[model samples]
Target: MKAIIAGTTMPVLELTLDAGERIIAEGGDVSWLTPGFDIQTSTAFGSGGRGGFMSGLKRMVGGGQLFLTQYTAQAPGSFVAFAAQLPGTIRELAIDPQDQFMVQSGAYMASTPDVEVSVGLQKKLGAGIFGGAGVVFQKLAGNGTAWVQLAGEIVEYDLQAGQSLLIHPGHLALYRAEMPLEFASIKGIKNKFFGDSLFLAQLHGPGHVWLQSMTPAKLAAAIEPYLPEKSSSDNN
Candidate 1:
C-alpha cells in the first residue's frame, strides 16, 4: 500500500492499495474511496493483533471512537482518502521499534495494518484540581506508519533530558512515546488570577513534541464575541 498526503494548510491523505492490502482508520474520517475497496467497521486491528469489544470500550474512555473503519482493496489499484475535520495539517509518522506516541484525542486519521491505536495513560484526579484539565492522549504503538491530524499551525520542539516546556492544556497535539507529560499549577497567587492561563501542562522530554497554535477551545474563545447573542428580540 502507498499513501499520498496532498494539499497544504488543509491537507488530505490518499492511499493507493494493492489487492488485499488493508488499512484501518478513525470512524467517520473517510472522505472518499475508489471502487474495489471493501469497508468494514470494527475495533482497530492490526497485522499485530485484533482487539475485542472490551478494548473498544477502553478506547472510548480515552476519547477515541468505539468503532474504527477498515478499508481493504478487493482488486488492484484501489484508493481511499481522509480529510481533516479541522483546518490544519496531516502528519505521516513512522512508528518503529514499537514506538509509542501519545496524541490528542481525535488526532488519529489512518494507519497501515501493522499499526495499533489504544487508550493513553490515565492521569490522577488531583491533576485536574484547581481548573487544571488533565489530558488523555491516544497511545499509538506497534510497527508501522500512522497518520495524525493536528490543529492550526504546528510548532515543533526537541528537548534534552530533564529540560521542560510549559504549555496550555489545549495547545498540546502530539509527543514522542518516551516524553513525560505532567500537569502543573500557575505559579503565584496574583499571577494565578491575572495570568493568561490558570493552569498549564509541562512536557519534559528527551524526545519530540508537537503543539498546535489553535486548539478547538482557543478557536471558540476567539470567535465567541462574533457569535449571535440571544435577547428579548429573539422571543418576538
Candidate 2:
C-alpha cells in the first residue's frame, strides 16, 4: 500500500491499494475515487458528517446513520482508520457498512465487518498559558502508524536519540508514540512578555515531530468577520 497527498492549501490524501489493501474514513469525507483506491472522511472532519455545526444540528433533529463507501476491495482482515480532532469527549461508536466508524473520547467495542477503533483525548490549554506552544498526542495502540491531517502550515523536526527540541504549540500535529511530551519554560519571563520568544512543548525524541501549517486561532481570526450576525454576537 502507498499514500500520496494531493492538492494545495486544502489538500486530499490518496491511498493506493494493491488489490487487497483497504482504507477507512468517515461517511462525509468522500469526494472522488478510482478502482484501485477508496476515500472516506472522519465524521468530525471536513464540512459535513458529525463535525459540522449544521450537520450536528441536523442529526439531533433527525436521527439516522450516515453512509460511506470505499473504491476498492480488502483482503478480509486488513483495516485502516481515520478521525478528526474534536472538542470535549467522544461518547459512542458509529460505523457504516463500508468499514467506517466514528469514535469519541471514550472506549467502544468492535466486530467483524467493522474496523476496530479507539478514541484519545487531550486537554485544551488556554492560549495565554502556553502562548505559541502546541500540544501533540500519539496513538498508543493499533499498528503504531496513525495518520493525522491538520489545517495549517507543517514543519518537521528531525531528532537523534537522546536529543531534544522545542516548538510552538500551534504548529504541532502528531509524533511518535515512544517520544515523551512535556511543557518547558522559554527561559526569561521578560523575553516571553516582550515577544522575543514564547513557551514551547519540549519533545525528547528519537522520532519525528509533525507540525500543522495552520492553527485554530488563526483560522478563527480569518472567519470571524464573515460569520452571521447572531453567531458573531455569540462570540463576543
The worst-scoring run of ten residues by lDDT in candidate 1 lies at: 124-133
lDDT of 1 by residue, 1-236 (tens): 88888998789999998899888887587898897678888764632365667767777877788887788899888999999878899988998764678898778888887776777766643433323344678888888889999999999999998899998767889999788777776765344343643557888969899999888766777899999999998999
Cα lDDT of all candidates, in order? 0.80, 0.43
Could you tell me every candidate's TM-score relative to the true structure? Answer: 0.86, 0.51
Question: How well is each residue in 64-121 modelled by candidate 2, as lDDT tens digits?
Answer: 1232233344443223332333221111223333222222111121111223233222
* Residue 155 of model 2, lDDT score: 68
What lDDT does candidate 2 reach at residue 65? 24
For model 1, what is the error of residue 203's alpha carbon versus the real structure, in angstroms, after optimal superposition? 1.4
Candidate 2 — which residues are off by over 4 angstroms? 16-21, 33-121, 124-141, 144-146, 185-199, 231-236
lDDT of candidate 2 at residue 3, scale 0 to 100: 52
TM-score of 1: 0.86
